[model samples]
Target: MTGIAAPGTKVAVTGAAGFIGSHLVEALLGRGCEVVGIDRRSLRSQTLARLHLGDVLDHPRFSWVEGDLTDLNLNEVVDGCMYVFHLAAVPGVRSSWTGFEDYIASNVVATERLLRACREAGTPKLVFASSSSVYGMVDTLSAENDVAMPVSPYGVTKLAGEQICLAYAKRPDSRLSVTALRYFTVYGPRQRPDMAIARILAAALTGEQYTIFGDGTERREFTYVDDVVEATIAAAGVDVPAAVINIGGGSSVSMIDVIGLAREVTGNPVPLTAVPAQPGDVRATAANLSMARLLLGYQPRTDLRTGMTRHAGWMRGLTPHLLRTYAPPPMITGPKEATCSH
Candidate 1:
């Protein structure tokens, strides 16, 4: 497959300050690409602090446009970009129950507007960061061909994202192509604080009780952050039709097993507690990476233990209190102050 990126290639990323987005930006810069990023968090704000973006925050090749995708000039983010990575959107299955409106605005409506912008800007490709939740509970491996019966509002919105991409790509006059990656339980250093791995590691650091929502046997295909980032870049580079592909580590393990890895990595195990499973929580997830391999030449290289060790080591550098006190940026719908460096 032909790849599009090269040194000095222009790229745009939404959710630039986020866990995966931050890592992607750093990787692109490492490849000598000039990157423009959009996120709701301000560079000067300490509220939504994440250590992942530290390396690229001041890199001359990186410029951040601050604000939600809906609030920003969509063309400004995607214009003249060879590839646009659309990773913006609120995440979490449980919270989707209560915050459905925010999911619609961020995940669905913002997506349509961004699609329009990409079409108008004539961007070659868009890589959307979708989720494994779109498959609901899968007894075996979740495939791109699986019936996407998303159990939560968040999943529904993500499926909406994939559909919207297909819809636009098929338009007779459209120039924008899209690749939607269904990431299966991405975990690594600076993972979103709400994710189980991050919360478990944080609890380990603080010696707090890490609660498991259900019996700890629920399993996930926890792809490493770096692996996810690699697949994302490949999606942008490989010349392929607009498609949905799974990005996973190919190793599925239980929550209890991950906790064991954390203990081995950190040498400090948090007290584990359990409760009945909540609504929309899946029993297990494993990704079918066949399409990723065939289409994007993707292969996941990180094992769970090694990935956990790297994650633990990265978190050890920061203050312990930062993990225990993370507040998600307020879900934005209306236009906020959109001024920033271009």
Candidate 2:
């Protein structure tokens, strides 16, 4: 695969301040594409905050726009940009149960708005950041072809967003070549504070007790952030009309193994608490990435242990609050607690 973009290929990335979004921006910059990043959150991650203050956005080839995806001026951002990487959304399956409206607006309505704007603007290609949670709870070995019975409102909204992309791409005179990359458990440096393995293991490293919901049996294919970014960039450059491809690390690991890895990575034996599983919690998820392999020439090179260690190392330098290890409140018994347990 050609890892470099030709000159003058401006790329627009939504959710640019986010974990996945920031990585995508960095990747696009490395590939020599002039980038325009749009996001609402500012100074969330310290690394990102450093990048923010470093005037990276002020580069001759880089620009930053601060706004919600649904409310942004799409034409201005989309102008002169041939590739759009849509990663902005209300995240977490459990959060959707209590806040369905946010999910609807951010995940579904925002995507629809973007698709409409792209259609109107004649953008040539768009790569959507989708979630594997659309599969929800399923039998072991969940594949792309399996029925997508999303158990969470977030999943439903994401699935709806993918449908919107495909439907928009199918327009008779559409200039868009849309591809939805369903990511599974993305983790690495700058992982969100609420993510599962990172939170659990990072807490252990800081001498904090962590809660393990659902007896640690739930399994997931935790793709590294870098791999997901690679796949996203690949999908964006592809000429495929409309495709749904799984972006995963291609291996399933249980919560127990994640805790074990955390212990190993942290070199600390932390206290643990067991809680009942919350709503929208899945039993297991494993992506069959054959479609992505054939279409995007994608390969996941980072294993969970290695990725977790990298996150742990990065977390060590940040404040304990970012790791959720700094004197956190009692275990949250609410439904939203289990939403991000990848």
Compared with the true structure, all predictions reach lDDT values of: 0.81, 0.79
Cα error, residue 69 of model 2, in Å, equals 2.1
Measured by TM-score, how close is model 1 to the native structure? 0.92
Model 1, range 1-342, lDDT digits (tens) per residue? 334457999999898888889988988898889999888877777544436577777899998788887787888778889888999888888777776788899999999999999899888788999999899877998889989998877789999988999899889887778899999888887787767787777778777777676688988889999898888988886566678899999888998998888888899976776666777788888989999999888888999999989988877876746755532223222222010000
- Against the hidden reference, what TM-scores do the models get? 0.92, 0.93
TM-score of 2: 0.93
Once fitted onto the true fold, the runs of candidate 2 whose alpha carbons sit more than 4 angstroms away are 43-55, 319-329
**Per-residue lDDT of model 2, residues 108-222, tens digit only:** 8888888888888888888898888989777776667788888888889889999999999998888788988889988887776677766676668666667777888888889
